[model samples]
Target: MDGVLVHEERAIPGAAEFIAALRRHERPFLVLTNNSIFTPRDLRARLHAAGLDIPQESIWTSALATAKFLSEQRPEGTAYVIGEAGLTTALHDVGYVMTTRDPEYVVLGETRTYSFEAITKAIQLIESGARFIATNPDPTGPSPSGSLPATGSVAALITKATGVEPYFVGKPNPLMMRTALNRIEAHSETTVMIGDRMDTDVLSGLEAGLRSILVLTGSTAPGQVERFPFRPTRVVDSIADVVPLVTELAEGDADGA
Candidate 1:
């Protein structure tokens, strides 16, 4: 979402129009994000602010996926959570108890303020026998100033201290794509994933058996894409270029009807 739809909170060219085209054609789609700092409602408002009218249900985050994963693992289990409102809220919704005392899991997510004190406590919890889990494998997040160390980097630090590697539940892990597919009841053969990065978005979608489209408005460049062993089903300038394809689908479906 940060790339394919909006980059740095600003709507990319023709992004809102593409969304409108999808809605008008009744296409089922989701705005996927590896960031676990914002809830669906929060994301919805963010997109809305950028002139895109995506619904809350249409936004899928690593936070929600992490919550779902934990819920499936142990219903109402306890975790020592490290993150912001999105991660905490999702865990609470899943009936998980957030604590530091002998938790069932040590859940980690992206946070702007990664305190040293919190990292120490997290390392202690992991060393004490709690399983480690993180939202995504991204080592850093983009910011106006530059790249900021993300959940993955912090997770690496914890792993070094406790000799425990965190199980990342977000992209480029196929688990994230599969869960989002399940949430939308979408079939791999029929669903299409549009993203801006080759390593995470395109790779995850391909591993999940969905057709992936790569856009050039973000981290991945055309030259770098060839370096990757895998490839997306299609490559476009941005979401703007996909509008014609979507319109074709709408027309085709109408004709079939």
Candidate 2:
């Protein structure tokens, strides 16, 4: 409910009321995000700073899932990371060493400090047979300002430089979705994914067999829907619309029951 909850540090129309409605009804929901720049705690703080009240545990970021995947892979050698502090810290916390030379793996995510030197070293590592891993494949992230290029843009740069495609560990990938679903304890049929991007958020839901809703407030615009192969079950203009749709669905379920 970040961008939909508050746009550009200003609360969206009826967003606070919608959240209040959810709290009043005791509906279970999770704010799942493919952006790896922030940890769950960091995201919660940012949202709170924007005046949207949410607990730290109520938020999830792709960095958390990427850390989990890296931990399981047991990457012992140095890793070339092209991401922000959150991604670097997550990887280091999971026991993976970080470096720019003779690395065992190259991990890519979002960072404002992305440099040509880092890209050059990453390509060299990939050429030297270092495994390439990406936190998420999202090329863009939404903000109050506008759409910003994300880790996927850097990933593409690495791909062009080295001709090697990295394995993605975030949303639209089943592993991350399964992780979030497990945390929420919601089955695919009972869960709904709400987001602004169709490729990452909506597709992740589809991959996990959950119902998906696309909102126009973020990366996706109304006209672009026709160009994509994957279509959301329902399309709304904003999170305010989502509240009514969810209420309708709840009533229908009750009637059927």
Candidate 3:
């Protein structure tokens, strides 16, 4: 949602209108993000501040996904977590106890301020036999100054210390995409993923057997498309271009009705 629907906290051209169209048509949709620091409620507030009216419940975050994965695989397990409210709250919601003693998993996630002490504890926990997991594979995230080290970079540090590779639970992983689809009860055959990154969004959508559309408002550029082995089903200038298509589809649905 950050890049596709809103870029740098501002609604990209036509993004708000497109979302309104979705609501008018009664189309189910979700705003997705790999950043696991903020809860869905926080994300909804952020989007609202940016002039994008996505609901709190419509936000699907990596923190939520990781929590779901843990609950299904190892219910009520203890975890040593290094992240912010989003990750911690989700784990708690799923009945995961946050602990540093004999944890079943050491979960890594994105945060504005990553504490060295927490990272050290994570490394120590993994060394002591806790399975390692990460929220996303993004090594760096954009900031007002420049790039800042994210979960993946910190996860690398833990791996180097403990010799244990962390399993990532976010975008570019088809499991993440499948969970998002399942949350909305949307069929991959009929759903189309709109994203800006080729590596994360496009690749994951393609892998999930969903149609993918690449928008230029975020990370990927038109020149970079040929560099990737796979391509999105469609490419558009921005969400602005998608508005018309959505209107047409809605009209067609009405006509059929």
Which has the greatest TM-score?
1
lDDT of 3 by residue, 1-257 (tens): 86788877778889889998889888899888999999999989888998887778899999999999999999999999989999999999999999988999999999898998998888888878899999999999877688899988998988888889999999989999999999999999979999999999999999999999999988888899999999899999999899888878788877994
Could you give me the TM-score of model 1 versus the true structure? 0.97
Error of 3 at 12 (Å): 1.0
- Which segments of candidate 1 are over 4 A away from where they belong? 255-257
lDDT of 2 by residue, 1-257 (tens): 54566666677776766777677667776777776777767877777787778786777677878888878777555788888877887888888888766777888888766788878888888999899999889787666577777888889988988889989988889788888888778798888888777778788889999888888887778999889988999998888887786577667777994
What lDDT does model 1 reach? 0.93
TM-score of 2: 0.88
Candidate 2 vs 3: which has more TM-score: 3
Instruction: Order the candidate numbers by TM-score, best to worst.
Output: 1, 3, 2
What is the model-wide C-alpha lDDT for candidate 3?
Answer: 0.91
How high is each candidate's TM-score? 0.97, 0.88, 0.96
Q: What is the C-alpha RMSD of each candidate to the true structure, in Å?
A: 1.2, 2.4, 1.4
Off by over 4 Å in 3: 254-257
Error of 2 at 63 (Å): 0.9
Summarize candidate 1's per-residue lDDT along 100-127 as a digit string, tens digits: 8899999999999999999999999888
